[model samples]
Target chain A: MDAKTFFIYLLVMAGTTYLVRAVPFALVKEKISNPLIKSFLYYIPYAVLTAMTIPAIFTCTGSYISAALGFAAAVILSLLGQGLMTVSMLACLTVFVSELLIR
Target chain B: MHFYKKGLAAGIPIALGYLSVSFTFGIIAVSEGFSWWQAVLISMTCLTSAGQFSGIHTMLIPGAYLDMLLSQFTINIRYSFMSVSLSQKADDRLRGIWRWIFGFFITDEIFAVGVTEDSVSRSYMAGLSTLPYLGWTGGTLLGALFGSILPERIMVALSIAIYGMFVAIVVPELKKNRDVILVVAVAAAASCVMTYVPGLSRLSPGISISIASVVAALVGALIHPVREEAAEDGC
Candidate 1:
C-alpha cells in the first residue's frame, strides 16, 4: 500500500470510529428516551457482527470443511457459555486438527 | 486502594483476553498484506476487533470511500450506545476535553468492567485501559513481525479466530434474546444475498455489510420497540 493511500484510508477508519465513541460520551448526558432509536442501537452490535461473520467466516480458512469445523466449534462452545478466549482457541484448534486430517 | 492500582488489577482479565484476539488480528492482517506497522497502527487507532477487521476487508476490496465511511459508521455505531451509557457512570475527572481522550478507550470489555464501578475517574479508567491497550497493540506487533514462523497449519487456523470471536459474542446473546436470533439470521441472509447475487456482488462489501446491518436492525427495532421500562432497565 502506498503510504499516503494507506494513511488516508486509515484516517477514515479511525476518524469515524473515534467520533462514534467520543460524540456520545462527550455530549450525551441524559438517557435516550426514544424506544425505537434505543432498540436500533441495541440490535446494531448483533446485526453487524452476524453480517460480517457469516459467509465471510466460511471462506476465511483454506478449506470450507476446516472453516465449517471451526465455525461449529465456536458456536457450540459459545452456546455452552464459554468465554471469548476459550471459544476462539478451541475453534482454532478444531480447524487446525481438522485441516491436518483433511490434508 | 489507589485508583490506578485497583484499576490495573481489575483490568488483567480483559487484558489477557485481548492478547489472544489481537494476536490473531496481527497474524491475519499481516498475512493479508498489511505491513506490520499498518496492522499495529490499526490496533492502536481503533480499539475494536470487528471494526478493524471490517475496515481491512473493505480496504482490501478497495471499496469506495463512501463505502468505507458508511461501513465503519454502521459497524461501530454500537460504541456510541456504550459510551452514552458510560457517560452516566463517569466521574468529574472524566470531564471537559478529556472525555474525548477517555472515550477513545471505551471498548466493549472496558465498558463492561467500568460500568460495574460506582463512578469511574480518569485515573481509574486510565489504569484499567492501559494494559489492555498495550496488550492489544503489542500482541499485534508480535503477530505481524513473527507470526510467519509458525507452521502454515497454525496460521490457517488462526485466520478464523476473529470470526470465532464474533460467534462467541453473538451466540450466547442469541440463545437468550429470541428476537436477536431472528435479527442476526436476517442480517446474515442479507449479507449472503449481496455476496452471491449477480449484480449485487458488484456492490462493495462495505456497502453490503452496512446495508444488511441497518436493515436487520431496523427490522428488530420495528418488531420490538424496546418498551420504556425495558430501555430504562438496560441503563
Candidate 2:
C-alpha cells in the first residue's frame, strides 16, 4: 500500500477500535441489573483471553516443540505465582534454548 | 496520590510484558512491509496486539478498507464490554473528558486491573495505563528499527513471549474459578472448530475469534449466572 493508503488504514482501524472501547464507557452510566448480561460481561475477559492464546500459541514459534515447551514453562511459572514478566521471560528463554537444541 | 503510586507500581509488570510482546509485533509489522515509524504509529494508536496483527495481515493481503475496519471492530469489541463493566466501578468524580481519556487505554490487562479496584480514580487509571502505553510504542520503535539485525532464532523465541504472557494472565484465574475454566474451554473449543473444521475454517481470524468469544461467554452466562451475593463479594 502507498503512504496515503496506509495512513487511511491506520486511521480507520484506530477509529474503529477506539469507538468499541469508548462507546461502552460513554453509554453505560448506570449499573447493569440484568444477571445474564452481567454474567456475560464477567466471563468475557477470561473467554476472550483464552481464545486469543490457544491454538495460536502453538503456531507462533519456529517449532511446535519449542512453543509447547514455552507454554508449559509459562503455565508452571504462573501457577507458582510468578509475575507476568518473569513467566514470559522464562518461557521465551526456554523456547530459545529448546529451538537451538532441537536444531 | 497514593492510589496513583500504587497504579504505577502495579503497571510495571504490565509495561514490561507489553514491551516484549510489542517488540515482536514491531518485527512482524516490518517484515510485513511497514516502515519503522508506521509500526510505531500503529502501536501507539491501536494499543491492541490481536487487532493490529489482524490488521497487518489484512493490509499485507491488500484487503479492502471495510475488511480492515470490520476486522478491527470484531477483535476490539470485547473492550467495549470491559469498558461498560468498568464504568460501574469508576469514581463519580471521573466524568466527561476524564472518562473518555482513560477509556482510550482500556486494554484487556488494564481493564482487568482497573475493574478489580474498589473505586477507580482518574489519576490512578492514568498512572496505570501510561507506562504500558509508552512501553508498547517504544518497543515497537526498537523492534521495527533493529528487527532485521536480530537473530532469526531470537525473534522466533520473542514471538512466543506474547502467548506466554496470555497464558500467565489466564492460568491463575482458571485455577481459582471453575467458571473461568469452563468459559476458557468453551472458547478454545469454539476457536479450534472455527480454525480446523473445513468450511468454517474459511472464516477470517477476526470473525472467528469474535464469534467464539461471544458464543462461549453466552453459554457460560447461561450455565453459571453470577448471584447478586457473589457479585457483591467480588467488589
Candidate 3:
C-alpha cells in the first residue's frame, strides 16, 4: 500500500475499533441490574484473557518446547506470587535459554 | 491529583509489559515494509495487538478496505464488551465527552485494571492511559527503526512477554477462586479446540476468542451468579 492508501485504511481500522469501544461506553449510562448479566461481565475479563493466552502462548516464541517452557515458567512464578513484570521478563528469558538448548 | 498519582503508579507495570509486546509489533510492521513513521502512526492511533496485525495483513491485499474494516471489528469486538463493563465502573464525573474521549483508550489491559477499581474519574483515566500509550508508541518507533539490528532469536523470545503477563494476571486469581479456575479451564480448552480443529481453525483469532470466552463465562455466570447486592445504588 502506498502512503495515501495506508493513511485512509488506517483510519478505517482505527475508526471501527474506536467506535466499537466509544459507542457502548458512551451510551450505556444505566447500571445493568440483572444478576446473570453482572456475573457474565464480572467473568468476561478472566475468560477473554485465558482464551487469548492458551494455545497462543504455546506457539508464541515459534518453538513448541521453548514456548511451553516460557508458559511453565510464567505459571510457576505467578503461582509463587511474583509480580507481572518479573514473571513476564523471566518467561522471556526461559524461552531464550530453552531455545538455545533446543537448537 | 492523588487519583492521577495512583493511576500513574498503576500504569507502570502495564507500561513495562507493553514495551516488549509493542516492540514486537514494531518489528513486524517494519519488516512487512511499513516505514518507522507509519508503524508508529498505527500504534499511536490503535490500542489492540490482534487488530493491528489484521490491519497490516490487509494492507498486503490491494483494495481490501472492506476486509480491513470487518476484520478489525470482529477482532476488536471484545473491547466493546470491556467498554460496557467499564461503563458500569465509571464514576459520576466520567460522562458524556469524557466517556467518548477516554473510552477510545480502553484496551484489554486498561479494562483489566479499570474494573479492579471501585470507580474511575477522567483524571485518573488520563494518568492510567498516559504511560502505556507512550510505551506502545515509543516502543514501536524503536522496534521499527532497529528491527533489522535485533537478533531473530531475541525477538522470538521477547514475544513471550505478553502471554506471560496474561498468565501472571490470571493465575493468582485462579488460585484464589474455584469459579475462576473453572472459567479459565473451560476457556482454554475451548480455545485449544478452536485453534486445532480443521474447519474451526480457519476462523479469525478474534472470533475464536470471542466464542470461547463468552461460552465459558456463560457457564460461569450460570453456575455462580454474582449477587445483585454487589451493584451500588440501584435505583
Decreasing TM-score order of the candidates: 2, 1, 3
Off by over 4 Å in 3: B53-55, B58-71, B228-235
Off by over 4 Å in 2: B1-3, B229-235
Native-to-model Cα distance after best TM-score fit, residue B119 in candidate 1, in Å? 3.0
B46-145 in candidate 3: lDDT tens per residue?
8876678657877777887777777677557767777887888899989999999998899877887877888899989999999999888888888899
- Per-prediction TM-score to the true structure, in the order listed: 0.93, 0.94, 0.87
Q: What Cα-based lDDT does every candidate model obtain?
A: 0.85, 0.84, 0.82
lDDT of 1: 0.85
Which model is ahead, 2 or 3, in terms of DockQ?
2
- lDDT tens readout by residue for model 2, B1-235: 8878888987887898888888889999999888999999999988997788778877765647887877788778778878887888889888788887888899878887887789989878988998999989998998899988999989888888777877887788777666777888999999998888999888777777878888888998899987774443221
RMSD of each: 2.1, 2.0, 3.3
Which residue pairs clash in candidate 3? Answer: none
Error of 2 at A75 (Å): 1.6
RMSD of 2: 2.0
Better of 1 and 2 by DockQ: 1
Point out the higher-scoring one by lDDT: 1 or 2.
Answer: 1
